[model samples]
Target: MHAWESIQASVDYIEEHLNEDLQIETLANVASLSPFYFQRLFNRLVNKTVFDYIKMRKLSKTSEILKSGNSRIVDIAMEYGFSSHSNFTRAFKETFGLTPEQYRTEPVVLNHFVKPDLILNYVMVNENVPLVTDGMVLEIFRRRLEQPRVFAGIEGEIPIEQLMGGETTGVAAGAKLWENFHKIKPRIPNLLPDGNELGALYLGNAKEGNCIYMAGAEIIPGTTAPGYQTFEMPACEYLVCGFEAENISQLYGDAVFKADKFMNRWLKQHQIRTAAFGVEMYYPPSQDAAYLEHWSIPEVDS
Candidate 1:
């Protein structure tokens, strides 16, 4: 097995045994490497020591349970292998800058250490080959829009840190924007009935540490929706990454995060230059599946 696969095996083991005591020697055996080598490889791939990764993951999970369940803090800590309440609180405060009691009373956006999707780092594909892993399918191809497309919806600005922090980082501003758009969508006129929605991110002000997020649907040109803002996506060639999930909720955060990482790596490997903005096309969800397509415009050569 490759080094990455070995590391991934150990990671999977760590996840499965998070509630149990994890020894370096046992993890090294899982990775089929010496203890010292396993530690080095894990740190290099995960950017965290094995101990730190396991602790953070446990804390992350416990935080969710705290928010949604009525479990006692001490019991939750013990369930996650924290030897004592004080140790758990100290670790939680060190990581999130809040005591477990404080966080449980009023939760906040947390920069969670999400599990690394290692396959995304190694997968490569083109139009002919689609990568499938963990019950999700990912494809990439090129598309061209023959004419400008107009989208009308609600717009909002989110801090770059919160945006990059994914779904666990407090209330999802983008999701709220989409919800607001849908609430007002019936009042808007001349929207295409194709059931496709667009969440476009404009990064022009990213240097200033903010992003503009627009959640809306495609509209016919010359169509006017009062009280709504319109963004015209110019005609251009785009590199599109398409993926499907078991449900719409699964498409956000984890799936999109992996797809974005893979897409960015693929672009860099192919020496492609992309525009400052990107669009996420959300198809109508169904009982069985949901689909999302991420579109990145490529810069035209002079």
Candidate 2:
């Protein structure tokens, strides 16, 4: 198997055995690599040591369980491989800034630890033969816009860090917005050609809980509707990365996270700093395979 596929398998194994003791030698065997080389490759790709990743993942899962109100804190701790209640609480508090008890009572978004997705489909094709792996072509392009694009739909705000959490308060807000949008879509009127759904995250130096999240559909100029908002997308040069998905409906949660992660790494590798704001555009299959485009502006150095 290829390196990316090996890493992908390692991640799958880790997920399946989060509650069990995951040994380095065993994990390396799963990836068919030596322990030393596996550690290096895992660190290079995952940005965390094997032990650290497992611990963080456990804590993350415990956080969710705490919110679920289904089990005792001690039970959860033991179930996830923690030695004792005190140890679990200490690690949970350190990772999430709240004890398990405290989190259960007053749950808030902590530094949501998202499992990193293996970007197997992502290929930087400046190399030989221009190959396509995993039924998707990943490309980043810098485009200067000549005119502002207008979107008429709904807007909402979500906590920045909460973007990674499971069914979070912020995610609920977005879900409600989309729910509302779909209910009123037929009445909204003058949607632009092509079924492209537009979304934007405008951070603008905002704190973790103060990010702006907007979801809308591109519309022809001068279209307006009652109780619907309009966003005049400012003209700017944008770094856009797109992936053509073979199955669009399945491209939620992990798939979306992986694509965004790949785009971030690609930008960092090229030293292309991005603006606080970004947009996601979804296109329907008739145009091509259903695809998602992630858009951002290059950060200006002061």
Candidate 3:
């Protein structure tokens, strides 16, 4: 059978026996292979191990039943193949950080828990920058932005001890940043050139002015630029700068000199690292998105 056929067969077997004593050996046998070979093939074809796929699928289905608030936790657990109520509860808590009961009580949350966009919430925080934590607001930005060139290194999903922060620096010390911009591809791209990005996630309210913007905010967020080489950009009007600054890094008051020149306030929230390489257009806002313009900062997606 083809790989897809094998995968479908294995998945069927798993869904039917979730509560039973499950293991790699059992599924490998079901897939008609040795455990080592089975595990490797599963990972290569499914982008997940057999163990993870089964667990996630079960938990997702259980979450749906729980949201209905009609079934008892034990019943829901059993239906999904958990060995015991305690075991089911433990797994649910670990996966969601909240108990089944607690999650179901929130009507909207329970309804949306299984939804991909709803479930995969991104947590962004820029701890190094000095700013107040209380008044920050994280907003969802959906807009198209003009793509620009930038310089920076890239980081990969690996151990830092292995190399220079894992993979190549998307932006090297002096490597023209835009050269490697495509390396850090956008998490998602917009459809039309004028289409908005998946979202322009806000870290928080703009502080006095320490906003850091990079150009590669969305890696090709707009409609394909075709020959021009499209780059990601959220199509939306930014709450342009109401804060002013000279140097981009020093937007925050780190040194005594910067402190003296610092704007009155800077919204010190977490930075969304997923946006494209963007430039911060700083200025004190007179009304809405308009501003006097201080310094430009490039941005990227979180």
* Best candidate according to lDDT: 1
Candidate 3 Cα lDDT to native: 0.41
Clashes of 3: 75
Per-residue CA lDDT of model 3 for 1-302, tens digit only, reads 76545655566677678656688888888888788988887766555677777777678677767776598889888877788999988888776567777777753221111111100112332322333211222222233335442222232122221112111111122112222444543432432333222111122332432222222332222234322223232344432222233333223211111221222122234332223222333233233222122222325444
Give candidate 3 misplaced runs (Cα > 4 Å): 1-5, 12-26, 29-32, 108-198, 201-302
Candidate 1 lDDT tens digits, 1-302: 88989999998898888889899999999999999999999999887899989888898888889888999999999999999999999988887778999988976545567677688777677774799876678999888898888888888886766644232334456666777788998887889878478988896444577899889888877677777888787887888999987777567756776677778888898888998888898888789988899999887789
Least accurate stretch of 10 residues (summed lDDT) in model 1?
Answer: 163-172
Model 3: per-residue Cα lDDT at residue 122: 21
lDDT of 2 by residue, 1-302 (tens): 77877876898799888889899999999999999999999888777788988898888777767887779889999999999999998988777666788878876644444565565334554312223444555666767777888887877676664554221222245555666777877777788877477777886555657777777888876666557777666788887777666676435433455567667767767787876677888776644466788888888889
> How many clashes in each structure?
0, 0, 75
Error of 1 at 81 (Å): 2.2
Candidates in descending TM-score order: 1, 2, 3
